[model samples]
Target: MFDFLRDPQWLWWLGAALALGAIEMLTLDFMFLMLAAGALVAMVAAALGLNLTGQFVLFCLSALVLLFFVRPVLRRRLEESTPLAVTNAAALTGRDALVAEPVTELAGTVKLHGEIWSARPQWDGETFAVGERVRIARIDGATARIERLPA
Candidate 1:
């Protein structure tokens, strides 16, 4: 059983590659996948009967090349294929809201996208009545800057 370990180093390398590949699936970063590729190269070196030092060198070179050259390309492609999603305050911009309380330039309240938020008028001396519709101008701290819709 243990006799195979003495002569067939490829088995160890192949096992390492498989383990790294498994870890890569959980991370999704592609770093461990590149290491698994290096381990596969080392397995090939072992099958070719290269000395331990030569196999290690080949593995190192393969890992470095893949990390520097292939990894960036793969990451960029992955980024490009994924859709950009807006959330939180960014998603609130340009949306309509209803005044929950009379809104003056200083402070008030509004129901924006189903949530009550602290709000202020967009311009000096501007005001909104309760039940009035307003457009969100921007967000500042915890407050939404709102402008009354044209009648």
Candidate 2:
């Protein structure tokens, strides 16, 4: 095995390509995969009896092309295919809540989506009586801004 590698320099290039491909699997960033593709191109050049310098040049050119062109397209496609997830305070907007206490502009309490939350009226001087329904307009720090629901 050692003697065969000495006779065929292309074997070294192929081994390097395989190593890079394995690293690509761990990273999942596509950068190592592009480098692996370049190494494979270098392996082809070595098999065709190109000098070491020529093989190096082929590898560099191939890697650059894949990094600049192919990588961006692949990244964009992956991003576009992924679904957007709503989380945290953004998830509470426009939801319904029940006034757990007399909700006034100053301070109050409500049950929002089964969770007790600090709340305040959406408008100045507005208030909600206990057991009234309200809509969550937005979240402000630890408080929910609420508007009274239509009768």
Best of the candidates, lDDT: 1
Candidate 1 local lDDT, 121-151, one digit each (tens): 9898988999999999999888999986767
Candidate 2 to native Cα RMSD, angstroms: 3.5
lDDT of each: 0.92, 0.90
TM-score of 2: 0.75
What's the CA error at residue 86 for candidate 1, in Å?
A: 2.9
Distance from true position, residue 44, model 2, in Å?
A: 3.4
Clashing pairs in 2: none
Q: Each candidate's TM vs. the true structure?
A: 0.81, 0.75
RMSD of 1: 3.4
Tens digit of per-residue lDDT, candidate 2, span 10-118 = 9888999999999999998899999999999999888877899999999999999999999999889988998888899999999999999988878789998788999
